[model samples]
Target: MLKSSLNIKVDRRDAKLVMAHFYVAFIALLVGGLAGLLQVLVRSGKFELPAGIGYYQILTVHGVVLGLVLTTFFIMGFQLAAVSKTAGTFTNKQRTIGWIGFWIMTIGTVAAAVMILLNEASVLYTFYAPLQAHFVFYLGLTLVVVGSWAVGTTIILKYAEWRRANPGQPSPLLTFMALVNTMMWTVATIGVAATVLIQLLPWSLGLVETVNVGVSRTLFWYFGHPLVYFWLLPAYMAWYVMIPKIIGGKIFSDSLARMSFILFLLFSIPVGFHHQLLEPGIDPAWKFLQVVLTFLVVIPSLMTAFSLFATFESYGRSQGATGLFGWLKKLPWKDARFTVPFIGMLAFIPAGAGGIVNASHQMNQVVHNTVWVTGHFHLTVATAVVLTFFGVSFWLVPHLTGRKLTKKMNKLALIQGYLWAIGMTFMSGAMHAAGLLGAPRRSSFSEYGGAAQAAEWIPYQIAQAVGGSILFIAIILMLYIFVNLAFFAPKGEEEFPVGEAANQTEKAPMVFENWKLWLGITVLLILFAYTIPFIDLIKNAPPGAQGYKLW
Candidate 1:
C-alpha cells in the first residue's frame, strides 16, 4: 500500500491547477505583509501615508488580503492536491470543473482587491453593515464564495467516485478529511451568502433604505466563527495525517482522528453566539446554550492533542528513548517541515486558552472590543494556521513542481519559522498587554486630547511596529524559498507523505462513511442553536441604519 501510494503522483494537469492557487497565495502574502507593516508603523505614531491614503484602507487590505484571499486559495489548492494524490488523479471533467472554479475565484479576488485599492471598500474584512462598501465589493465577495462552492463541488464529486470504486472499504484518510472540511465549509458559507445576497447587496445598491444591524451581524458571525474552523481543519489534517509520515512515525489511530473531525463539524457551527456575547437583544439563555456548545468544541481539540502526544511518545519509545521528558528530545528538531508546524502546535496552546476566555461571557466583558481579541486571532490564524501552511509549502511546492527541497532551502525555512515566532511574541504579546491596560482595537494612533490612559499603550504600539517589521522580513524569506523550490531546486521526486495507522488489523468503522447521518446531525445542531436567535433578531430588530461610506 505504501509503495503504491508513493508511486501515484498528482497528474501534470492537476499540478497546474494547484500551482495557480499558490501563485496567487504568495502574491497576496507580499501585498498583505507590506500593508501590515505599514499599519503597525502608523499605529506607533511614527509614520504617515504619503498619498492621502486612509489608515483603515490599508487595514482593510491587510485583513482581506491575508485573512480571506491567502487562506482560501492555499487551502483549496492543497486539498485538491491531497485528493488527487490519495483518491486518484481527477478525471478530465473534474479537472475542468476545478479550473473553472479557479478562474471565477481569481476574477472575484481581483475585483474585490481593486475596489479596496481604489478606496471604495474600506469596510474592513468583516464588511459589517452600516459601514457599507461599494456594490461591486459585495458582488465580488459573493462571487468568491460562490466560486469556492464550485471548487468544493469538484472535491465532492471526486470523493463520490472513489467510494463507488472502492465499495465497503474506507476512503483514503486525506481524501476523507478533505471531504469533511469541504462539506463543513459549504454548510458554513450559506450564512455569508444569505447576508450578502439578501441583505448587504440590496442595501449597498440603494434598493433598500434600511438594514438591520443585528441580523446582519448575527448572520456574519454565524459564518465568521466557523470560518476560523474552516482555516484550521486543513492544518489539523496536516497534523493528524501528514505529520506522522514526515516524522517516520505511524498515525496513532484512524478511528480517533475521524471521530475528532466529526466532533469539530458538530460543534463548530452552532457556537457563533460566543462572538456576540457583548451584543444586545439576544436572550441570555440562548447565549448560554451556545456557549455550552462552544465549550464542546474543546473536547475534540483535546482529543487531537492527546493523540499527538501518544503518537510522539510511541515513536520515541520505539527508538529506545527513555525518561518522561526524553521523548521530546527524540523529535526531529532539525527537520524544517516538522519543526515549523510543531511551532504552530505550540502556538495553539495559548491561542486555545485565549479562545476560552473570549467565549466566556464574564471574561469576555473584560477584554471585549480590545486589542486582546486582535492578539488572540493573530496567534490562532496567523501563527498557528499560517505557519502550518508555510510548513506544508516547504515540501508541497517542490513535490508539485517535480523538484526536491534542497538543504539550503530547508535551512532558510527554519529561519523563516523562528523569525515568525519571535515577531509574533513581540507583537501579539504587546497587544494582549495593552488590551489589558485598556487599548481599543480597530483604531488609529491618537492622543485622544491628551488622555492619560492612551499614553500607556504607545510603548506597546512601538513594540508591535518592531515585530511587524520582523514578520515582513520573514515573509520575504518565505517567498524566496517558494521561488527556489518551484523553479531552482534539483529535479527529483519529493514524497507526499501520508501515514499509515499504527495498527493495521484495526479498521476504521464503516459507519464513519455515512455522510447522511453526519450531515443530518450537523444541520440539526445548527438549527437548534440558531433558529430562535435568528428569528428574534429579525422579528424585534431595530429600524435599520442607512449605509455609510466612512472612508
Candidate 2:
C-alpha cells in the first residue's frame, strides 16, 4: 500500500487538464498583479493614471482577477490532479467531463475579462448591486460558477467510485479534503447564484428596474465568508497531508485532520452573517447568533494549529532534538516547499486574531468598511492561502508537467516567498494602521478637500505603494519559476508526496466518512442561521435602487 501510494502520479491525460487550469491562473496573476501595482501607486497620491483611466477600474480588475479567477482556477485544477492521483485515475468519462468544465470556465473567464477591459463591468469581485455591470459580466461569472460545478461533479463521482471499490475503508485523505471543499463551495455558491440570477442579472438586463440592495448583499455574504474557507481547505490539505511527507515526517493524526474538516463543513457556512454585523435589515439577535457560530470555527482552526505543532515536535524529537523549541531548528528552512507554507502558517496567527475582532459586533464597528478589514484578508487569503498555493505549485506543477523542480529554481522559490512576506508586512501593516486612523477602504486616492484626517493616511498609502512594487517583483519571479517548472526544467519524475499517519494502525472512524449526516447538519445550521433573517430582509426592504454605471 505504501509503495503504491508513493508511486502514484497524476496520469498523463489528466495532467493536460490540470495544466490548462494553471495556465489561466498564472495569466490572471500577471494581469491582476499589474492592476494591484497601479492601485497602490494611484492611492499613493504621487501618481496619476494616464489617459483618464479610473483608479476603481484597476481596483476592480485586481480584485476580480485575483480573488475570483486565479483562486478558483488554481483550486479546481489542484483538486482534480489530487483526486486523480489518489483515488485512481479518472475514468474516460470523468476526464472528458473535466475537459468540458475547463473549457466552459475558460470561455467564461475570457468573456468577463473582455467586459472588464472594455470598462463595461467594473463592479469588482463582490459585484454588489446598485453598482451594476454589463449583463455579459454576470453571465460570464455565472458560467464560471457553472463550470466549477461540472468539475466538482467529477470529483464527487470519483469519490463515489472509490468508496464502491473499497467497501469499508476511508477515502484517500486528499480526495476527502477535495470533496469537503467542493461540497462547501457548492452549497455556499447557491447564495451568489441566487443573487445574480434572481437579482443582479435581471436588474442589469433591464428586466427589473430596481433591486433590493439589502437582500442582494445578504445573499452575497452568505456566499462570501465560506469563500474564504473554500480558498483555505486546500491549503489545509497540504498542511495536514503533504507537508509531513515533504519534511520526511509522518502525519500526526489522520482522524484529527478529517474531524477538523468535518467541523469546518459544519461551522463555516452558517457564520456568514458575521460579515453583516453592521448592516440593517437583519435582526441583531440573528447577527449575534451567527457570530457565535463564527467563533466555533476557531475551534477547528486551533485544532489544526495544535496538530501541526505536534507533528513538528514529534518529528523534531525523532531526530534527537531535546529543547522545547528545538523543533524550530529542526525544520527544513532551506526547502521552499516546507518553508513557503510555513510562513503562511505564521501569518495565520495574526490573520485569525483579526478575524476574531472582525466577527465581534462592537469591535467590528471600529474597523468596519475600513482598510483594516482589507488588511486582514490580505493576510488570510493573500498570505496564508496564496503562499501555500505557491508552495504546492513548486512541486505539483512539475509533477504534472513531467519535469523536476531544479535546485536553482527551488532557491529562487524561497526568495519569492520571503519577498512576499516582506512586501505584505509593509503593505498590510500600513493598511491596518491607516485604517485605525480613519482611512476608508475601496476608495480612490483623495485628499477629501485636504481634510486633516485624510492627510494622515497619505504616508501609509505611500508605504503600500512601495510594498506593492516589491510584491510585483515577487509575482514576476514566481511566474518565471512556474514557466521553468512547466516547460524548461529537465525531464524527470517529481514525487507527488502524500504522507502516512504516525499511527497507521489507528483507523479513521467510519463516522467521519458519513457525508449524509454531515451535509444534513450543514444545511440545518445554515437554515437556522439565515431563514428568518433572509425573510426579514425581503419583507422589510426599503425602496429598491436602480442600477448605476458608476465608472
Candidate 3:
C-alpha cells in the first residue's frame, strides 16, 4: 500500500503557514515550560532570589502566551490544511487572509510578550473581576483575537462555498467539525473578549466603579471550556480520521468520529464551571450542574479512545500480533503517531481513571487544589495534545523540508517519546501521592507551610525536577533530529511518497451521518445539564448559590 508518489497536490504556501504556526507555538511552550521549571525549583528550596515582580509577571505571560495564543493559533492553521484535502476543497484567497491573521496575531503576541517581560501587568492571565490592568495587555489581546476571528470567517466561508458547488453531497465530517469548532470559538471567545473590551478597559480607566465577579467567572469559563476543545480537536482529528488511515486500517467507525465532534460542540462549553467547584459566590448548584455535565463530557473522550484502540487492535492482528495483548507488540513503534500517542494514552489511563474518582462529589474535597488536579491536566493535555503534535510533526516534516528523515533520526525521536512518557509518569505519580498527603497546587513555593506538608513535598519536588530535566534533554534531542531532517539530511531526489494513507481511499461508510441517534443523545444530555443548576430540597448546596437561577 505504500506508493512512492500520488497525484495529491500539497499547497506549499499552506504548508509554510503550518510550519509558521508550530514555530511560534513550540517556542512559546518552551518559554512557558521554563517558567514552570522555575516554579518547581522555588518549591523545592533548590534556589531562592528576588525573583520578585518579574516572577509573577513571567507567570502571567507564560500562561497567556502558551496556553492561549500558541495552542489556538497552531490548531487553527492545521485544521485548515486537513479539511482542504479530505473535502476536495481549496482556499487560495482565504489562505492568504489566514496568513495575514497569523501576522496580526503575531505582532500582538510580541507586543504582549515584551510588555510582560518589562513587568507592566501581573494579572495572572485570568479575567478575575476587579483585578484591573494597564490598557496595553487588553489592546494587544484585542488585535490578536480580531485577526483570528477574521481567520475563522475565512475558513467558514470557504467551507460553505465548497458545499454549494458540490451540490447535494455532505461535506467530509472533519471539514464540518473544523467549521463547528470555528463557530464555537467565535461564539465562546466573545465572552472574554467582550469583558476585556467593554468591561475591563473602561473599568481600568476608571469609567466604572465595579464589574460583576460572579458574572465574569461564568462567562470566562464558558469561553474556557470550549477553548480546551479547540486545542484538542486538531489532536482528536488526527486520532480518529488521520491516524487510522495512516496506520493502514479502516477507521473503526467514521460515524463515531463525527458523533464525537458533534457531542463536543454541544457539551464542552457548559462544563467549564467544573473548575469553579471550590470558588465561593458562584451557586453551588450551578457548579454541580456543570460538574455533572463535565462528567458527561468524559463519555465522548472515552468513545474516541475505544474507537482508536480497536483500530489499533485491527492493525495489530493484521500484522500477526497474537493473543489479546500481543497486538501491542506489533505496532510500528517507529511511527511517531502510533508510538507517542500510544504511550501517552497509556499514561493517561491511570491518571484519568483516578480523575473519575477525583471528580466525584465527596472526592473533590480531598484533592481539589492539590497536585492531583495538576497531574490530571498534565496527563490529558500532554498526552492528548502535545503527543499528537509530535505525531503530526513526523507526518509533515519531510514533506515540508523536501528531505528524507534518516532512520537514525526517526529512532532517536521515538526514543525521546518513550523518555517523555516515562518521566512524566514518575513525576506526576509522585505529585498525585503528595496531593493526597496535603500538598497544594499552583503555589509559587512550598515555603510558608507546616513541617508535615513540607516533609511530604520534599522528595516529590526533587523527583519532579529530575523529570523536568529528562524532558528537557528529550526536547534537545528532537531539536537536533529536526535540524537534520530539515537541513542536513540529503535530498532524496526521488519524488517523496504521498502521505502513507492516501492510497487506501476506498469509500468510507456513512455510519456517522445518522442524525436521529445524536438528536436523542443530545436531548438527554441537555436534560441532565438543566438539572445541574436546579435546587431540589433533596439536593444539598452551600451558601450564596444554593438557590440558583436555572434559566
Candidate 4:
C-alpha cells in the first residue's frame, strides 16, 4: 500500500489573520528598502537623497525600521499560530491585543523613522556615541519595544492557556518554538530595556545631568545582540519545522527541532559582545568569552541549516532527484511553496559566515565601523531575515484567500529571491574589500577620496540599488497576490483541514530539551567572562577597584 498525500486546506479566517502580518511586514520592508537605496546612493557619492542631513539619518531609519520592526512583527504572526494550534487555543481577545501591539509598534517605529529622516537622530540604530537623538526618537523606540513585549506576553500566556487545556501531550512545535523564543525575549530585552527606560530616558529628557556611556553601551548590547537572535529564530523555525511540512516531509528529527529551539532560547542571551568586539568592554576576558561562545551560538543555526537541507535532500531523492548534490535541483522550485523559502536560507549561510568572521577578535578590528560591517549585517538581518517573512507570506496567501498564485508572479518572486541573494553577496563582498582598503561606514562621502576599489565599488553599489529596486517591486507583487486571495479570488466554501494542517506541530517527548544543555554550556562561558575579570579587579585594587574601566 502507498501512503497518500495530505491536501491541507487550513481555516480561511485563521489563515487571513495569520497572513495579514506579512503584508504589514512587507510595507515596512518597502519603506526600509527605500531608505537603504538612498543610503547606498549617498555612500556611492553619486546622489544625496537630501543634502545636509546626508547618510547618517537615512541609514539610521533604514536600519531600525527594516532590521528590527519588520522582522519582529512577522515573527509575532508565528507566535499567534503556535498559540492557536497547540491547545486548540485561539482568542479574539488576545488576538485583538496582538493587532493593537502591531499598530503601536508600527506607529512608534514610523515616528522614529521620521525623526531619522528629519536628521534629528543620526546616531545610527546602535544610537551610541557623543551623538544622541531627540528624546522623541528614544521614546518612540522604547514604545516600539514595549509594544512588542505586549505581543510576547500575549503569546506566552496563550501558550500557557493551551498547555492547561491540553493537559499531557506536548504542545505543537510551532507553539513550543514561540514559547521558548518569547521566554528568551523576556530575558534578553531586560538589560537594554532597563538601560533605556531607567537611564537613557531620564538623561535624554534633561532630568539627569549625565549617564555613564561605558555602562550604557554595555547594558545595551547585553540586550541588543540577543535581539538579533530573536529576529532570526523565526526564520530558523520556518526553515526547520514549517518548510518541511510545506515541502511534504516530516521534520528530519522532531526532537532535534525542539532541541534547537531550546538552545536558541537559552544561549541566545549572554553572548552579547560579539557585536562589541572592537568597542571597549567590561574586560578583555568578557570580550574573549563572548567571542568563544559566539561560535557556540552558531551551532544550533548550523544544525538547523544542515537538518533542513538533509530533510529536503531526502525528500528530493525519494522523488528520484538522486545522487550527491543533485537533489538540490529536484526541489519544487516553482511553488512559492518551495522557491521563496529556499534562497532565504541560501543567503543566510554566507551572511552568517561573514558574521562569524566579523565576530572574531582580530578580524573585528579590521571591519569594525566599516561598510563591510554594514554589508554583512545587511545580508543577515535585512536580506535573509526579511526574505523569510516575504517567502512565508507568498507560501500562505493562497491558503488564506483560497486562490492560486499566478505562475507569472511565482516566477517573479523566485527571480526576486535570486536577485536578492546574488546582489547582496557581491555587494557585501565589494564592501568588505573596500573596508579592507579602508572605508568607514556611516560616512556620506568617501574620506578615502580616490582608492582603487573605491571606484570599482560604484558598480556593486549600483547592483545593490538595482537589487533593492527589484526586491521592492517583488514585495508589491506579493501584496497583489495576497490581495487577490483575500478579496478577488472566489471564496471556497470547502471545509478546512485541522491537525497537522499547520506549518509544524510539536515532536513527541523531547528529553534533550536542549535548553538545559545550552544553559550548562553558557554558564561555563559566563563564568569564564565574569570570574577572571572580577578576580583581576580584586587583585589590582588600589582604592576603588570596582570603579575600574578595563579598556
Give the runs in model 1 whose Cα sits over 4 Å from its true position.
1-7, 447-449, 544-551
Q: Which candidate do you rate higher for lDDT, 2 or 3?
A: 2
What is the TM-score of each predicted model, taking all chains together? Answer: 0.97, 0.97, 0.86, 0.85
lDDT of 2 by residue, 360-450 (tens): 9999999999999989989999999999999999999999999998899999999999999999999999999998997988887664527
lDDT of 3 at 195: 69
- The positional error of residue 40 in candidate 2, measured at the CA in angstroms, is 0.5
Q: How high a TM-score does candidate 4 get?
A: 0.85
> What lDDT score belongs to each candidate, Candidate 1 first?
0.90, 0.90, 0.67, 0.67
- Give candidate 3 regions above 4 Å deviation: 1-7, 49-53, 125-127, 354-358, 449-452, 492-551
- Residue 409 shift from truth in candidate 4, angstroms: 3.2
Query: Per-residue lDDT of 1-551 in model 1, one digit per residue for the tens?
Result: 32233235788888999999999999999999999999999889888887988899999999999999999999999999999988888889999989888888889899999999999999998988778889899888988888898889999999898887778888888988999999889999999999999988898888987777787888898899989999999999999988999988999999999999888888899888999998898999999999999999999999999998899999899888899978888899988999999999999999999999999999999999999999998999999999999999998998999999988899999999999999999999999998898888888875342678888888999999999999999999999999999999999999888899999998889899999999999999999998998888877776535322322
Off by over 4 Å in 2: 1-7, 447-449, 544-551
Assess candidate 1 and give its lDDT: 0.90
Off by over 4 Å in 4: 1-20, 51-53, 401-403, 446-507, 510-551
* Residues 109-197, model 3: lDDT tens digits: 88777777777667776746655567777777877888788778767777767656664555565676687678667766876787678
| Candidates 1 and 4 compared by TM-score, better number | 1
**Backbone clashes under 3 angstroms, per model:** 0, 0, 3, 3
